[model samples]
Target: MVEALTTTIQTASLILAGWCLVSTFRDRPMLVPHLVAVGVLWLLVIAQAVVSAVLMSGGEGPAQTLMFVSYLVFIVLIPPACAVWGFVERSRWGPAVIAFACLILPVMLVRLEQIWNPAGV
Candidate 1:
C-alpha cells in the first residue's frame, strides 16, 4: 500500500471511531449520518482494495498475497456487518458496536499494510 493512502485510511478510521464514540456517549443509536459516514468509509476501503489488488497482480505488492487478500476481504465486510448489527440492536450500544468496529479498522489496516510491506517495522 502507498504511504499516502495508508495515512488517509488510518485518519478516516480514527475519525469514524471518534464519531462512533461520541454518539455512544451521547446515548445515540445508529443514525443516518453514522450510516453515511460508514458508507463513505466502505467506498474508500473498496478503492484501496482494488488498487492493492492491481499492484499485487503486477508483482509490485507483498509476497504474502493470499494473506493480504484475506485481510482485504475481511476489512471490506466489517462496516456493513456492524451497521446491520447496530441497526438491529437499536440502543446506545448500537453506536457502541460501531465504535468498536471502527476501532478495529485501524488495527486491521495496519496489519494489512505490514503484510503488504513486511520489510518495514
Candidate 2:
C-alpha cells in the first residue's frame, strides 16, 4: 500500500466526483469525455490493485487479509459498473450516479489504506 498512490487515487476520485456533480447539475448526460475520465480513473485503480496484489503475494499484506482483498476487489469494480449505469441511463441522473460512486470511492480507498496499515503497525 503506497501512501502516495492512495493519495493520488483519493484526489483524482474527488475531482472526478466534483466534475460529475457539475455535469449533473447542468442536466447533462454522461458524455464520452466523462466516460474517458472514468476509464482513466479505473485504470489508476487497476494499477493500484495490481501492485497491492503483487505485494500481498510477496507476503507483505494487511493484517486482515481477507477483508483487504474483498475491499480491493470491490474498489476495482465500482467505477466501470457505475460508468455503465451512467451510460445506460442517458440523463442527468446518470452523472449523478457517477458522482455518487466517485464520492464513495475515495472513502473506501481511505478505509483500504487503514486496513493495509493499521495505526500501531
Candidate 3:
C-alpha cells in the first residue's frame, strides 16, 4: 500500500464525514454535490486498490493477504453503498448515514495499513 495515498484517502474521508455531519445537522438530504464528492472519493479508493493489487501481484504483498484483500474489498464497496442509501432515504438521516460510513472508513483504512505493513516488520 502507498502510505501517501492512504493518508490522502484518510484525510478526504474525514473531511467528507465532517461535511455530511454538517448537512445532517442542517436537516438536508443527500444532494448531487454530496454524491459527487463521494464519487470522487470512490475513485480515489479504486485507484489505491488498483495500485495495491498491482504491487501484490508483483510479490510485494502483505503478510495477511486474505485479510488485507477482504478489507480492501469492503473499503472499495463502502462509499457507493452508503451513497445509494443516502440518496434513496431522502431525509436528513441520509446524510447521517453517509456521515457514519465516512467516519468508519478512515478507521478501516488504518487497519488496512496495519495489515499491509505490520509495525517493526
Instruction: Give me the candidate number with maximum lDDT.
Output: 3
Summarize candidate 2's per-residue lDDT along 1-121 as a digit string, tens digits: 8778888888989999999999999999999998999999999999999999999999998989999999999999999999999999998999998899999999998899889889733
Candidates 1 and 2, the one with greater TM-score: 2
Candidate 3 lDDT, 1-121, residue by residue in tens: 8889988998999999999999999999999999999999999999999999999999997889999999999999999999999999999999998889999988998898888889734
For each candidate in turn, the TM-score is 0.94, 0.96, 0.97
Ranking by lDDT: 3, 2, 1
TM-score for candidate 2, residues paired by index:
0.96
C-alpha lDDT score of every prediction, in listed order = 0.86, 0.92, 0.93
Any runs in candidate 2 off by more than 4 Å, and if so which? Answer: none
What is the C-alpha lDDT profile of model 1 across 1-121, one tens digit per residue?
7678777877887898889889889998889898888888888888888888888778798887788889999999998999889889898999888888888988999999898888885
In model 1, the runs with Cα more than 4 Å from the true position are: none
Provide the RMSD of all predictions against the true structure, rounded to 1 decimal: 1.0, 1.2, 1.1
